[model samples]
Target: MTSDTPARRRARVFSRRRSAPSRARRRLGAAVRMIAALALAGGVYTAFTPGAFAEDNVQLSAAAQEGKALFDNSCISCHGRDGQGVEERGPSLIGVGSASVEFQVSTGRMPMTRQEAQAEQKTPQFDETQTKQLAQYIQELGGGPELPEGELVEDLKTNPDALARGGELFRINCTSCHGFGGGGGALSSGKFAPSLHDATQEQIYAAMLTGPQNMPVFGDNQLTPDEKREIITYITVQLQDDRDPGGLFNLGRYGPSTEGMAIFLVGIVLLVFTSLWIAGKS
Candidate 1:
């Protein structure tokens, strides 16, 4: 074989070095492609698999289940299976929450005596625990408004502005039927929207949730829970601050009509008595 030229040998060595780098680059690209493929596979697998981060199921207690069964059997005729109520028979129990259930059941207004214009309070059919279970059963059936934990009544002192806001809300919503000063009003039927003067915060809340008798339901969608609390505060504060100057018993704050009647009857009797005293002295 003839001896190789210096230029030719140098050219061959440079080509070999360039080819080695090209081979290494190809291997590196293949490795990156494989890694990407593996990552995509992992993502697909996770998405298809069940129970990855599933929500926990709500569990009912035995009593609640039993109550639900009883409700279905006895009450569902009027109340509906879902407790949304029938059109003419019963009102929706959805979002009325536990407080209303307790009040209605404990007072024996529920499991009604008959379909009447109003349900009168009487001896309770269910005990406290049973009442609570029934309430829970209704609550779980169709989620609606619920009472907050701890005390049912919240202190209005926490937010003074709530009272002001509540008054405005009351005027807009309740004043039409309950009157401007919480004096109850007559309804279409013999039913009346009872005075708020004697109602507590919880009672007011329950009334709003339950819609009691002829009153229309104010669901959370219509009036939020916070707004309900504010309304209660406004009513309570008004009742507490209303001090009568005449030392006369105010008949549920019926305003001018009752006041005028009282003055006419009592003032006439007093005037007659004074005239009799003058004649006796002469």
Candidate 2:
């Protein structure tokens, strides 16, 4: 009887040990399931948040959609499906703001006559509202530089100090292509940077916003709208205000080359005339 009892006890102990592993495995599975559920909830929360997945659904107005369709049909052949132009055709419109679109389209320089050295103003294809709609569409497609919602004209007097600030901004921003004095310069190919001498405040603002022709677009991100206006103020008020001591016929403000030519031609003509008059008198 004692031997039988000892054997039975040992067998019972073995069975209990074997069952422990099964219990542990069940617990582990439950834990894994709990962890997976928590992870799924976290992922759901992140996805629904603003700017997380919302950007994908940014809807355009009806006008913008129409404009986009028009752009895709008419402009995209050369400008590219996404407004990133092909080499030597159009430039990337990624950041070019509505102001640029408005200027180019409204002025009739867009839907270009042909690929040329520069696009000159002609009869516009779209009316004012359509132009604005196109601008809005482009603005929405790729979030970039935008014209301020309210009035475009800013209070020039409030930031009178910005003129000096603008001077610095101009030197850094405008001087490269427009030159230090806003005289403008030549670009690659036959394209030339148009002189700012004749540009009005709105025109300059529009140009900075639009980046017409071979000029690369400078978005508000690249140069803020306020900074743009300040630049316009500096160029128009300060630079344009300062008059040349020399009379009309500023000779393109190109300095010595033009002056030298004028001196040689005019001086030679005067000398020859003076000599002829003296000989006639004798």
Maximum-lDDT candidate: 1
Query: What is candidate 2's lDDT per residue for 1-282, written digit by digit as tens?
Result: 456688899999999999999999999999999999999999989876532221345688898888888788778977786676678877766666677787778777788868776887677898878888888877776655455555443576356687887889988877788876678898888777766776656557777766677666677689877887778777766668753313345676644466678989999999999999999999
Candidate 1 least-lDDT 10 residues: 49-58
For model 1, what is the alpha-carbon lDDT of residue 17? 97
Clash count per candidate: 2, 1
- Once superposed on the true structure, which residue ranges of model 1 sit more than 4 Å away at CA? 1-59, 69-100, 157-160, 180-183, 197-200, 220-222, 240-247, 255-257, 272-282
Error of 2 at 85 (Å): 6.5
Candidate 1 structure, TM-score to reference: 0.58
How close is every model to the real structure, measured as TM-score? 0.58, 0.58
